[model samples]
Target: MQTRMIDKQWSEKYPGVGKGPVATEPCISPEYFERERELIFRRHWLNVGRVDEIPTAGKYFVRELEVCKVSVLVVRGNDDQVRAFHNVCPHRGNTLVLNERGTCPGRFGCGFHSWAFTPEGKLAFVPDEENFFDLDKSQYGLSAINCEVWEGFIFINLAPMPKQSLREFLGGVATQLDNSPFSEMKLLKTYKVEENANWKTGLDAQNELYHLPFQHRYTIGDSFLLKDGKYCRFSNVNLYNYHSVWSCEYNPAHKPLPTEALLNRMDSALTNIRFDKRISDFDWYLIFPNMALLLFTGPSGDFFMTYNFWPLSVDRCLWEMRYHFPPAENVGQRLAQEWTIGQLRDTLMEDAFQHEKIQKGLASRACSHMVMQDEEITIRHFHEVLECEMAKV
Candidate 1:
């Protein structure tokens, strides 16, 4: 047998993360989900999008936060400030922006009564102003939400007064990942799928690498460093106060496909792109509640991706996947980027399929809790954090 220094390395490093099976009630219980929706999602800094999305003035987008039952409109005003407002007209309680996302006019006009609001969320006009009994537009601006930006990611808090600021809530996550080169990359591809599974179920599935070699065998089975030449193991792991991060080295012996070989010869393939921020070949961060930030080393340059699991119901969630990469300069580089995107896209599709089946299994109640190993410490720690947060009065 291959000699090893320590078994259960993660738990040994982080002793508070107990070694035990975690209850599945958080994944399948409707009552628990409601508590999570109020105590966890609404109170935390939920990442909505990136500042790059609204690069220019008058650009805006709308997001329907199903978990909190609110529609949010994120906009960039002419003053070059980004802001978010409730996507509802104050006049008749109608939706202010019907489109999913687009550039705003001088003012957003309500379809119901033609009430208009400026990009800054100020009420600009109301049709037949003189006909109103004593209407004051100053007091009728769009309802604003708590919005903040960190490392190019925009997060919104639904709490009337958040327990902590975005930076404070991020805790060590902010300090470790602060000043990352996220602004260097550009948006590449986006995919959204409405999965019939609890948000945590999907998030838990992606937070560990124990399933990488098994569930992703056909896609990225040998992509990570393995132990005893059979199982994957993390190169580094850090469990923060409210968030966690795990990183693993890429397998050096694995052979690339023919296409990848050709692409590498033409341009830098998905080889390591050295950066000061990268801790390993791959870094996966669970940004608490429902967002994941991933940084990957590519040959040409480094790239990043984000995963947002938005809860639709206790048993349903919307999974959003987005990729950002360095701008390709040549045709070969473009082709290589496309291949990289396709490779990851396929892998995530497999994950989406498995999430539903896992939900089904959890619904069956055959097992009340999920057994954990040293490799799956992140998932266990996540449930612990979930329980701790949900328990808050």
Candidate 2:
């Protein structure tokens, strides 16, 4: 199929404000990936893990987004605050945390030189106390990054000084979800998958609903209205500097039977809950440079779920999906909601399979660029944001 160019009329109508040109070469270039690691991933506020993941003092989790060669340590301090530190030891630059996650016995000991650090990244001990003369323990502590938690998810920025705070980075997108039940939602399960594709390729596949009808037909195809879906409801797509939001309600014209039934059960189980089942919506918050946060509200108004993405490399990425439920819901209702997670999992597998094929295709010389349509405004906007950032580098 021939790739469709952005509508000239749309560009003329919005003139100077429409989507930018599509990037075909950069998407498949290894050289571009190297620059991306330096210009984008290293400087952005990357999502590490959730605050709930390390709930107790001394608890810690390591996030290895190796593309940028970044290994971050998310630790819960004695003061009950969560902090992120570079997982490298000061001496010989050995990795401080070897395991994915575990509880630190009051301090983290580097296996290399037995250097110990408090959960707050403060140096506490040295193996040979008298071995090194004039070695200042205070100056050799684990280096820390700017860390913050927003609505339960922990975020870290590697920049010595970030240009924008997490709150400022989130902007109005955070306010739109301020009334959401995310803060109270407990983490039920986490599913991680590594896709063999550029992080942008995986993100491009997710930023739009245009592919749902064609790509996920056997699964969620019937659940969403594709061509018939309205463009400006629930929340409108807003493109900021490097971030974008593609917000809309599920089209009422094509709500599937199973989805409708799920919505009814949701209402019956929750009190004082009212959702316009016909117009149930979700928002896809794309934190550019790299990251996609999918926020969904069930048709029954009983729960919310988020899919957080972290780019592992130029051609690899990791996704962490968490389901959230109300604190008041009974075990039976929560369990029923949990079952929905299975359906989501199936849909994700479907997406992953297609993304891998696209990656292979992009690697081939036969095909060059992909097409875009009005419904794919989200994906188009993403490329625009990426190109803008690349130009600055």
Candidate 3:
């Protein structure tokens, strides 16, 4: 089959820099979805699960690559190492694990042929051993895949040998995470939303702040400043990858905390804390290809939150928002943090619901392409990176 090349006129007009309206068809086309499964998800360093999920030995989690029709069993081995394996039996191809997450009893046995394997992918036992006279149990171990953990997040590359290691794939983004508070935080709460939009569409909506005023009017626009929100900006208007880092400062001049609200939430230490008058900001790190880490800091301490967008189908995505907070000893502090999380949850729901409607509108035949302006540079860069990656394959 002849691959349709990107038009020469389009390339010439954009010249040196590829800037053009991305066609809406890519979001709804089945062929593009197949290409993404092979070129993007299968070849890239995709986030599988968090290390906290498999903190102890024998702890395991199952992650499904629905597009590729594969399931992976990620386990923390007795040797204090993490490993991932094709969650299938060697005897017949039945999945070894059915549950989403659990603690394996040091060994996994397939129900079909009773083929047993150790946590480290070593074949341990086989029922009716004598019946298989020439069969070698040692050679029939569970198939293993490439897996690594970075900053407490487990990443899996489905390719037999990934072109780049996870660290190399992340590049400078990993350094930014080191300075953030993710390593020292505790899980607060997680909210999962299933949206009827392509993963890129949902991610594009979150990557830029341009739509905050119009789309997030009541939820965040009331408190967020349109022009002065961002700080510590990093922009890479490249073809294959793009990233941006910025900070949003909370408004101090708006109004002092109400007496009752302060008394209910503030601790003695927090009340006495002196904040840098100019530094009441939250830092946002968007690593292109697919991940977002948000760090919020004040004089007291900090918290980290992660947003992972997983593509389920061409027009369906599973968005996970996980929050991490500083460890709290007092009950009041914990409750106050939970209240803050509740406010964020409500705000995010408003944002995600609006994106679903946007997806429906994009699917309409009336809209052929998306128009991006200068203020939406992040969204433009995202489309450029995606098109470049797709072109390579």
Candidate 4:
């Protein structure tokens, strides 16, 4: 159960990360969660989906963000521009765009009162035009939110104006992963789980590898084969503006499971597209607030995954992990991709099953603050960034 000696001096390595006990109140208090909703979730750039989801004009999707307490309808205008608006009917405040996603043929209609609208948020038709006076068709339309895109990912901000652009928010993480073949891969599998735990608590677990060798012992522990079948050591940690990145060293001599063997054979066949990252390293990026971009090896060099943690309340959050891969041309490649999905699902269940217990423990007030190890520097850095953003609220 020993890990190879990596740099244990996290404070010394990243002196700015600071040494402090992360208070338990932030994780279990409704008031603090409210502040987070106002400051972080509302103002910060949030990645809702990919551009490919709405490739054609008039294609739209509704994202129900419980944290922000608003349903956002993201649509592609006739000009091929993407935008977001509050998914509410202007006349009666009825929920607009009930379906999760679809193409509206450049127009949308409110089923509640038969109010029609364009993809550009313009009123196209009204059921009772003569009934209501001063019903300016131009004025009564879906209120728009600040929307932007970065590297094909659609992002939205509920704030009247976001403090920083998506590029600024991404900063170093973007530079590090700029060469990453994210666009070459498409979503292959998606796992969504709602758990009874503070969003921060679940995020803390994901932001570090401290628990991987232990908590995922049976599911992924054997796969890692770290020294005595335990311990995960990060090669390096880099903190960027409002974000962080870590590198995981893949042990070349490590033993692979049966499925991995098949994955390897299929992977070796696709030698045309070789990325250094896919060979033996995992570059994990933690975007501020609640996005994790992890690029690692799959059956091919074009594989990656994203973990999005959306807060619903002080004691609950929705966790989603999406696996992305290049289009498979052979059955072996397809099976390998499916095997990876199954493995991730099993591993996440082990993680989800413990969230409620953590929330309950924090709520009990058994401890005022929790300790952080050098190996878990990212968790500490995450709290520091969160506190800074919350201060602005």
Candidate 5:
């Protein structure tokens, strides 16, 4: 492949995201992290999981939001409505739903006491009701949380009164991906890594194409189209209010490995899926606070991936990665899908190795700020958004 000439398009388009050094305090200071917990994580809409996880009535899953120290119970009720509630027993404040996920019976029973609640979160039974003094079971129903479904993803807001609905918080991102064929694909694999790094550090590294050629040199260094024979350039960049989408072109002349070439020759069902929701060959969207949606136009099919960075402390975070692909119909197709997972998993492992090293450098106080580049405009814009949100009183 040859080098192509390109201009500083993103910087020119998003001038308000100044081309200045971004401070490291937000990623290093313990006090700053505490502020983020209250002002950012507690207030924004956070994605817990998808509705498919609880497909049938009475099926539920529990998500622990360590940043806010809250456990969320997401379930499908007998009415077939998806709802969320705080996973805390209203009677004695004991943690409810100890398991990660389960199929609820007619009612949920607290193992500590004999209190029981319906799948609809209504208090159904309490031992020796006559002994209580004018107790109202209706008044002690499970504490509900603001939960909403978008496309198939479930989101919960911890705010007493959310400043904006999920649709409003998503802004332009929803408009662009309105009818995306996300439900057509099935989850293929999930990977979670506990990293010794700030949550933002991992997200910032993945948000830009500047490090693709260097950090991922062995795996996907040449996968994206490059400029000046060295740097990868974005085909398009859309900066939304509190969110952003970046698209890049793939190198058409790149060669495939032996297994990949063999799978391409086979009549694999992995190639049967396709959708028209792409802005370029690849699109990466940042759903504000801590989620990322990645769309890929692969040789076999169109697939998508998601990333969630959950903060555990000032210097520790959980990085979750999930891949979704078209359902396989035969053994060959399934093998091909597994191969696709392996390729991406290897590349991401390279990224996971760098996160800890980056955190160590930031903690050393050797550098007060990080210098930005034209291609790293998304990272700069993200920091700008973070600062604006943290400035709220």
Candidate 6:
């Protein structure tokens, strides 16, 4: 058994931690997971992509969200405003924008009937214009979903009428990270993997730092837990509305692996790169249902990455990791960032490979409840939020 940190127990120190013996049914049950699809995923504000992906007029991309069983087409109009609509053609319901992303010029046309809709989602043309009666052009236009942008990130709500604006939903998260360089930073690269585990199961693994030293022992263990003889405690965990932020102690003196050490030692200039001027090396933010904003401060450019967990089924989810970095000024800078990326990839692969085994274990119904420690407060809070949202209907 791991040594439990009693003094740093957030569940007791903080009043909000939810009551739970975290259940396995929520991980493996199809019926209850369906309730999650209807009650939670559809109603929540879900992050889809960043504005940088579509910077010019008439640029658009189709995002297929399996959780809601709806494909969303996000567009940048001639007016330069970003918007989203159902990807289905308004007439025959044939899918629109077959390509993952492309420039629409002025509008997109369905391949089946050649019905074209403007970037602003207005019905522009149809080949057989004289066939139908009472065909109001305005009525036949593409249907729009509630779309909003925050800090250059695009979020789409499938709710017929969103309960609150994205600003209202994000609350203090906006104020806290308002100054982040999200608008200016560029996408360095993206890594994607499909996990055969419930979305929650995958997300739960990342909400805290307790597992870093053990699960990631070979790759990142020494960095988080130095030869120091003391247990490393998270600096603090702050909860807001339904979202939460957790910061952990970072050892500035933490040594790098042999390859990285050799690279940095060879080029002293690489040490000059700093991910951010933040106090902690890591600040992880969980946005309710499915978004994780993992901000970092490292020896390379100050940038933040995002983890998007898109559910495909009760026991399957598509997981994506996006890496954002400031443009590299020199070869040294690029190599430094690549070094970190390699380590992160290896670490995430470890976590990803284990998720399937966890799913299989949960399927066994080997245990009714999984006991959680004080360090796992965020996981408990996540389950609490899911239970609360699911109970609404």
Clashing pairs in 4: none
lDDT of 3 by residue, 1-393 (tens): 111222232234335444567678877777898898887778878777678878888899997878677899999988979999999998889989999999988789898887888888888998888888799877889898899888888888888999988888777667545444355667778898989998887887887655666666555553443334331122212222345554454544333336425634563234322212212356566666567777665333566788888889989988889988767656666666776677678778987997798788877757898876544555666667677778876
Go through the candidates in order and give each one's C-alpha lDDT. 0.88, 0.70, 0.70, 0.81, 0.88, 0.82
After superposing candidate 6 on the true structure, give the runs of residues whose Cα lies further than 4 Å from its correct spot. Answer: 1-6, 225-232, 265-279
Model 5: lDDT of residue 252: 71
Q: Which residue pairs come into collision in candidate 3?
A: 231-247
Alpha-carbon deviation at 274 in model 2, angstroms: 9.1
Give the better candidate number (2 or 6) by lDDT: 6
lDDT of 6 by residue, 1-393 (tens): 122334646866677676568888998999988888889889999999999999999988889999888999999999999999999888988888889999996778899988889999999998888998868888888889889999899999999988889999898777688766766567898999999999988998888777777888788775653324344556667777778887765565667778888766543333333534343667788998899998786554466789999989989999999998777777876787788788899999999988888888988899888888767887888788888888887
Tens-digit lDDT track of model 4 for 1-393 = 223465566678788887778889999999999888888898889989888789889999998999988999999999899999999998899998989999986568888888989999989899879898878899988889999987777889888978778888788776655565566677788889899998888888877777887888777765542544467777677888788877676665666788678677765445334454432466677888888888776546557788889999999999989888877867777787788778878888988887778888989999999998787888889889889988874
TM-score to true structure, per model: 0.96, 0.86, 0.85, 0.93, 0.97, 0.93
Comparing 2 and 5 by TM-score, which wins? 5
Candidate 3 — which residues are off by over 4 angstroms?
1-19, 228-242, 254-280
Number of backbone collisions per candidate: 1, 0, 1, 0, 0, 2
RMSD (Cα, Å) of model 2: 4.7
Candidate 4 positional error at 121, Å: 1.7
* 263 Cα displacement, candidate 5 (Å): 1.5
lDDT of 5 by residue, 121-163 (tens): 9999999989999999999999999998898888999999999
lDDT of 2 by residue, 22-137 (tens): 65677678788888887777777877777877889999999887867878899999999999888999888998899999999988988887888999899999888898989988
Error of 4 at 260 (Å): 3.0
